[model samples]
Target: MEESNRIVEKTVHTGQQQQQQQMSSSLPATTPVVNPSNPNLQKKQQHIEDSPIANSLPTDHITDVDEYKPPTAEEIRRLTWKRDLRIIPLVFLFFLFSFLDRVNIGNAKLAGLMDDIKITEDQYNGALSIFFAGYIAFEIPANMMLNKLGPRVWMAILLVVWGTILASMASITTGTQLIVARFFLGVAEAGLLPAIYYYLSVWYTRKEQAQKVSLFLTSLSLSGAVGGLLAYGIVRMDGIHGMGGWQWIFIIEAIPTLVLSIVCFIALPDYPEKTGSTFLTEHERKVLLDMLRADAGPAPENDPEFSWKQFFSVFKDWVVYMYCITVIGVIVCIYSIGMFLPSIVRGMGFTSLNAQAMTVPPYILASITILINGHSAARCGERGLHVVASVLLSVVGYIMLIALQGDSLAGRYVATMLITTGAFSCYGSMGSWFTSNFAGRTKRSIAIATINCAGNLGGVIAGQLYRDNDAPYYIHGHGAALGFACATILFSLILKLLLRRINKKRDGLTGEERATIIAEEKADNLLEKHPDFRYIL
Candidate 1:
């Protein structure tokens, strides 16, 4: 038995040496060697290195292979919960304020912003549309900065700057001033959503991200609900210090955002590998890193240094454009509903204060739907179907809005609930789908920024969709939103089919062919081009 044990140990040691040699060829020889004298530690390490999860990562990316041990299921669960507790609430509040500052113009309009500024409806719409001009222009650059400065510093800077700009809205006396403030506000806020998405991607695996993203994004609906309630109260403060209710709305909302900016700067973790938090033990950190590497494999993009070539190369992918267009459709519905819900409710014959209060319920309903759809997608491991179902629900709501009579107040209100619920739920799935589909951190960053930028163009489209001319049953607006919803469904199906076809082609290649392709791609540092890099459809 002693001789047999010695022979097995020899075989394991030989295998470890071979693996270490293989890894060293692709990466620097920096990994510490495991102590062969510690038999139990050696056995545990060997078991982990042999596991399917460890084998999924490329050798070049396994920096701590000698030290890795597979975390127990309970350990992973507890760690995930701890991460959720630390990250979700703060990020959620940040985005909640971000979204509120963007859409609060709608609340302010109902509180007499347009009349106070002496702007025509067309000019008001122009102000709304122009924000996206700055937002789209800065998104990619902002994400590049976030990658360089790290999430904590970059995001906090953005939050504080935008919060200051958002407050300055209370001081604008002319349409031009309001327009300029809105534009700069857009520029300041541009980096935040995409930055948060990228930050979360680095921390969590593809499977774990959707639900977390949903929780974070629930801030959108919460902002709508909370903004409505706040607006209801603030509007009553009209003429206080000779400022309009709209001005009070801007001032009050800005205060909390500025406070949170300081909190975020101090509290937010940079990245898992660089985190200085006491919440995670050294072993937990190692396990987390290994899990992330295993989930996506490694690429040159994982390196801290920025690559302009890799950044621009994202534009070359047809899949990226598909995702961009798909999100645009969804964002059209979301922005239109979010911007116009108060107006839509007021048109149903409610007073201004009652309309503000009325906006809360649909958003509350939407928030509930978003959580359900997000969790269900994660649980079922499906993306396209859940997104399609949600958008179709919006289409149905739009159709009901068009068909139902204005006097049928309760029914039309139900339709509004459906619209909010459906439109909001699609966001979480679409975000997770696109983020996971892209490989490489730099490429993923640019892809996410581009998609989000394109999607925000929907805000421009939405600004013009619901005009005063289309008053009490805005058939044109409803019809246009319905069309976008259908387009989203069509685009999602096409992308899914295309991905499946590509995955199928990959599966049919022989081992030698795949091996040759992988070697050639690896030589070029084209990680996504590797034959084994499967799409997540």
Candidate 2:
């Protein structure tokens, strides 16, 4: 008995000594309570303390725990600003022209694309729907390529390929040719949206991502406005070099894309670790990485050896399908608006050029709303409700479109503002919401790709909805979009409730039981399924 007692004492003393040594190295500062006055700082400190690395630290080291100082808010701000300056501009520009290239076809239609090609209304709709065939089919493969080749290389390549295809549209003489060119353009651009989401996920934590994504995706709304102004001016060059005004729109817009592709190759940062030393100092890199690990558990290093098991495991998650369903509705509304707004405006008794220019105000307002919604979501740390609210706004707009009289052009124009603002705002919130929930890169890539693939089907549906025959009011299209918007609200609410229930169930577990489950999950590479992982609603 005495010998056992001696052994216990010795073991306790050794553990205490080891902890002291760790405490010495880990927490040299004497500040017991730094930034206690700021609630955000305190919350951040608590978050780090709850992380796996922090949980592994010796609990007996009370002095070390008290003295520990988390990175200051200023440091985080500075590093974030540095990353934003380098990363967002390039990605934003790429998305801008990619979107411009994609939707400029709408502007081209107003510029007499159909008249030149002699395509009937049904054939014109077929051309639009055909784009999403390549878009949906290539999404998974393209994202797989993004995972294999680093984003910088793959994104630059996509830009070059799509720009070439878009420019070639200027030469197409038949409706079938236009359809073929648009399909290839879709194939090249498939990876961009998912890639941008995944790429931003690498740099920022879940909370920070919405704002960054919002700012980046602002290009979606702004591109419409920019496309309008550009189309307005370019269509005036009808006789320039004997090319049609529609040809000029395609050729002129494709120039920026080809030029920017070179810039992307030269300047775009690959990954946080792969970023140049000049861009992020070693110390800054370490600090940034530490913050990431604390927020989400330790992510694998950039370009970790690909695992087939991880790649295939994405199909097991049911939540991704729910996300897929919700986003479909949002995509339908957005694509319909983007593809047909000019036509709709023209149908309201305006000339084609005037219609092209008028599309600008709705898009500009939508951009402002997107920024505001993203900022609000990030600040409040909520996503589903914001999405719900935005979708509701769209429902209201669609109602107006269906119920408002034909001569109420002014009222219909305001309805377009509501629809554009609501549908476009959902992109950033929805992208960040789900992308943040998945942990591993392979799982994230496949899940994003899958969700995107399903969502792009809405593009196909949207193409069919706003037929030329359903001109002016487009009651059927408006009504269908409204129904889908309500569907979005339903699915979003369901997803939010399901995630909350799961989180609540996990919270009910005993500390030891929770620890055991987390260990098992970590061993099996269960990632976001780990008990400690909480989904953001």
Candidate 3:
């Protein structure tokens, strides 16, 4: 009776979700990985295989195969929603401090950090922006190593490095000193975001990753809101001896990260395969592994070692490029506003306290925007619409700020919320898009690292975009940010169209033929061919 019920449930749900399993008659005659007419796509693909990109990382070698088997809706939900959610809060809490450590410097400046250090204005700006230089240098290697090292150790180690550096920053007396420390701090923090995304992929299927990405990425918003209160409160505190508020910003915030590091060492699980026999019973382990295997095929445990051919394969994929470009434009809008919003608010004639207070609203809006779109995307198995909407919202926000000259407190306040909401929403949506589009350990890791590395370049540029000369109005900053938002729209359109074309080409095969193609695509594993995986919308 139990076996009969299980069979009935799987059939009913699978038919509802994927009735059109057979490829349609009008599909392309032949769909080759290589194309002649599209140079940019060809170059993007070749770029993955050439020299540094191909040889530089671990994501190139293994893709566990799954056969196309129709999973019941019950099985789909079990893998993605339940498993993906468990690790999200963990990533968010860790990143909360990670972002805080980076941006709280801006908060510190408002609290008179520059004055306390006796630094020139230019030097202070230099210190604030220097972290990106270091961040860009080590991102890929760090992410490559992150999976090999595993999240439990890698994340904690990264936190310790950055958190310790953050604490050490309090002792610096000059701008030069601060810049050097921040540079190293960036190096330490470099792999974390991409690595966490990659790590999250191991546990959750592409179908489940969107909401989880949003949940994890929401830390940036939480950081904005909570960092303000923390920065506002801590900077004002009466501390030991004669240390100022910014000094405490370092010391106080660094402590929690340190505490979490220890907790991470104790509490975090490495992978299901290495089940240590203590935390989860054998039955629970089998259940969890069954869910992942159902969705992603099987996690190939015994495999050939990493190779350049495989590492370069990700670059050839094309999806990563679209993901990277789309994210770069949006992240610029995110960091540009983030880097300058406090200063912009202060420039509008409000005191530092009031300016800080003004930032709170944007973060509130950002938190909700990120989570809602992300959750919807994950639930509906969609990735395209939310990303486009997020960018469109940003375009509106950017146009409003750039086209209109506003000096009123309410006007500047409103602009901040609009830009923040739109930019952060795009960020969350893009993250969901990223994981859903890539498969296999090698491909996903390199894909995430490469995309993030490109996106961080925008951070380097954002530091320069906000000019001191435009202080009273900052028209130049608003215009540049708007331009990037428009670029975001372009990339979004291109990515959506490109993926749609790929989907159409594959649509011609029979259901069984299509399953065979996907199984081969997932790599050589025989087990992964029949999972009935669908493209994350």
Candidate 4:
């Protein structure tokens, strides 16, 4: 009995000593943000963002989750920033053009594509529908290729191809030409977003990803709002006087994309080992890497070679299935910005020009909300509630749109603002949720591709649902949006419950039981060796 008491005392003392050590090591070697300081956050914002490639090592390999691993910290930090700096700007440009080219058909519509191209309304829908056909066919393969090729080569190639397709839009004269240009563009652009998400997983721990992703994704909102304004400005130039407004939108937009593609190739900073000259102060670099090592384990040095066994392994979890369905519902409503906002606005009494003008404000509100929620979630270490709040906000907006009628423009306008806010609010939260919950590069890659494919499928359904006959109110489409938003809320709750069960199962196991659970070590949390470690639910 005395010997057992001694053992317990030693264990207690060892834990106390480790806690003290952690507190001390948490202080930076040099004050972080020691140079490029923001006055308000200079002190408290010691937390840093790493380049994505810095953390390619496995997490469970760390000796202890609670104990500080300084060498590991530095390695992860440098790797993460290297990947982030290279990848974010490149993917940002890719999505910017993908979104702009796909949706600007609406801008062209107002500019007279329908009358000038002699496109029948039915055939116009067919041309628009074909983009997703290509989008669907290529999405998974693009992401799978992204997993294999790495961003430096794959993303740049993706940008060049998509930009070429966008430029080709300026030359299209017939409905068939429009159909082919848009379809091939969709195929070219298909893998970029999934690839970005998969690539981010290579560098960041789940907690670190949201704000960085938010910064890039807000580009989508900007494109939605700005794409039209750009079209408006381009169509006004004197040298372009004889060109159709649609042609001007395509030509001018493609020029910037052409330049953006070239810059992205050189500017992209891939994995940490591949990081260019030290653009970041050593202190800043160090803090960023340490943060992710503390959050998710390091990214694998290189993705494991593809195998049929691994490919089939993605079905082992039910979360992947739930997430697949949840994303389908989430994106159905979320796509309102890209797929429907302009059309819905045009359906109102506004002229084609005025309709294009109005799509800007809602997305401006969306960008603001996304930035705020993304940073807030990462800061406070909370994620799900924000999504719930955002989706509920969307549901309320849809309700107002359906109940309030077009007579109340103020109410309709307010609803539009809320819709953008809520949808993107959830989008910003949801991506990180997937990252935070899943483990392993293989599973993460498959899950990302799966969710994205599911989400883009929503675009296919959403496209056809908004009918010309339902104009002014779009009663059926609005109702479909509402139903899907509600479904998202319920599924989110269900997922929360399942995760709680997962946590409970985790908690009930004894150390010996956990260690003996028969899961593969490389794939399981090595940090499970620590009692306080809990999977983020």
Among these predictions, the greatest TM-score belongs to 1
lDDT of 1: 0.83
TM-score, per-candidate, Cα-based: 0.90, 0.87, 0.81, 0.80
Residue 51, model 4, lDDT? 19
Q: Score residue 202 of candidate 4 by CA lDDT.
A: 62
TM-score of 4: 0.80
lDDT of model 4 at residue 180?
86
From the highest TM-score down, the ranking of the candidates is 1, 2, 3, 4
lDDT of model 3 at residue 333?
Answer: 84
Candidate 1 lands at a TM-score of 0.90
lDDT of 2: 0.83
Candidate 2 — worst ten consecutive residues by lDDT sum?
1-10
Per-residue lDDT for 1-537 in model 1, tens only? 121122223334555554454355445566555678989868866787775334433444444645456555466667777788889998999999999999999999999999988998888998989999999999999999987899999999998999999988999988999889989998999999999888888888777777888889899888999999999999999999999999999999999999999999888888888876576887777767766765664444346767676788888988889998999899899889878989999888999889999999989988988888888877765788889999988989999999997489998999999989999999988888888777777888888999999999998899889988888788899999999999999999999889889889977988677667757655336656655566766
lDDT of 4 by residue, 140-219 (tens): 78877866776767877887788778877877878888888878988997887787777776666565677667767777
Instruction: Give per-model CA RMSD.
Output: 6.0, 9.5, 11.6, 9.9
Clashes of 1: 0
Pick by lDDT: 1 or 3, better one: 1
Clashes of 2: 0
Q: After superposing candidate 1, which stretches have Cα over 4 Å from the reference?
A: 1-70, 298-301
lDDT of 2 by residue, 1-537 (tens): 121122223334444454444344335376355378878768766775644334323332234444454444455567778888999999999999988898888999999999998999888888889999999999999988998898999999999999999999999999889889989999999999999998988887777787888999899999999999999999999989989999999999999999989998989888777776888877577666655654564334243556677778788889988999999999999999999999888887899999999999999998998889998888777899999998888999999988887689899889999999999998778988888888788888889999999999999999999876778778899999998899999999999999999989877877677667756654337677766567888
